[model samples]
Target: MYLTSSRPDIVHTTCLCARYQAKPTENYLKEVKMIFCYLWGTINTGLWYTKDSGFELTGFSNAYYAGCKDTFKSTSDGAQFLGEKLVIWSSKKQDCTALSTAEA
Candidate 1:
């Protein structure tokens, strides 16, 4: 959890890696160990909230057309924030086809 929260740069890679966790090979285990070592070496790394930034809330939504090769379904993505904190995010496959980005 800490690793996922702290390392946004690796989120995509980690998610791909996690798909193999149910049947992880030796290489996958090695990569997991490396991530653990990185976390152990940088345990102090995390968000440091402050009070005086005069922050505001903002959000964004994005989607891709026909992201699933097998089903040809679209994918939707969203991210919301309060100040500089990331409050919510999601990536999911859409149930219907999107004619355009707007439709998605």
Candidate 2:
């Protein structure tokens, strides 16, 4: 949750991993380790909001049909920006299953 504020790229994978916390396996551990490795490699990269940027707000969203391997639920993600600065983002599994890409 903490990392999500600054690292939107990890949101979906992290959220997916979080869902298996109650019954984590070796694969899950490996995935977590991979995230740590990625963080280590990109320690110097980070978000930087500038005051000179425009004030326009923009947003984008997408859904992956049946993205969850375990539950066959779709995953939805979105990001919002204030001008050129990113202000909000989210990645989550949908509450209901999507039967097709269009539905997703």
Candidate 3:
């Protein structure tokens, strides 16, 4: 949870794993270890901000609809940026049958 602020790249995976924390299986354990291994391998990576760049606020979003398997729902992901820095991001399961970003 502490690393999410600094490591937006890993947030979605982390959250996905977290959803099964109440009843974690062997696969989840392996996935968690993989996340740790990935972090260790990229210990030197980080976002950098330059002083003279423009701070244009931009947002991007995408979503997918599978079917009526478990009610009408969609999986969506999005990121919002203030200038070049990420301000908000999320991967969500929403209660709608959305196929694309605009519909979601």
Candidate 4:
């Protein structure tokens, strides 16, 4: 969960694995290992911001209705940016069930 703040790319996969934390199977462990491997391979990768860049804030959001088969809950995700640099992001299951994408 902590890592997701800086590495948004792993948010979905990590959250999926997190759902199985109570009774993690081999597959869950494998998926976590894969995330670690990916991190190791991209240790030097990161976003950069230039001092002279334009100042702008932008946001994007999306949701999937009834995405979780176990709970029939929707998943919503969003990201915020300052110019070309990502400043915030999040991905989580919704509290209430969503019948459609718009509801989500």
Best candidate according to TM-score? 2
Q: lDDT winner between 1 and 4, please give it.
A: 4
Question: What TM-score, computed on C-alpha atoms, does each candidate reach?
Answer: 0.54, 0.93, 0.75, 0.90
Give the per-residue lDDT of model 2 (tens digit) for 1-104. Answer: 78977898889889989999999999998999999999999999889988798899999999999998999999999999999888999998999998899999
Residue 28, model 4: lDDT of: 87
Model 2 misplaced stretches (Cα beyond 4 Å): none
Candidate 2 TM-score, true structure as reference: 0.93
Ranking by lDDT: 2, 4, 3, 1
For each candidate, the alpha-carbon lDDT, in order, equals 0.68, 0.92, 0.77, 0.89
Error of model 1, residue 82, in angstroms: 1.3
- List model 4 lDDT by residue over 31-82, tens digit each: 9999999999999887777887667999999997898888999998899988
lDDT of 4 at 44: 86
Taking the candidates one at a time, how many backbone clashes does each contain? 0, 0, 0, 0
Every model: Cα RMSD to truth: 4.3, 1.1, 3.3, 1.3
lDDT of 1 by residue, 1-104 (tens): 34565555445446545756788889888888887787788777766666664368899887777766556667776777778777666656787888776787
Candidate 4 shows a clash count of 0
lDDT for 64 in candidate 3 is 60
Candidate 4 displacement at residue 48 in angstroms: 2.1
**lDDT, candidate 3, at 26:** 100
lDDT of 1 at 30: 89
TM-score of 4: 0.90
Q: Distance (Å) between predicted and true CA of 80, model 4?
A: 0.8
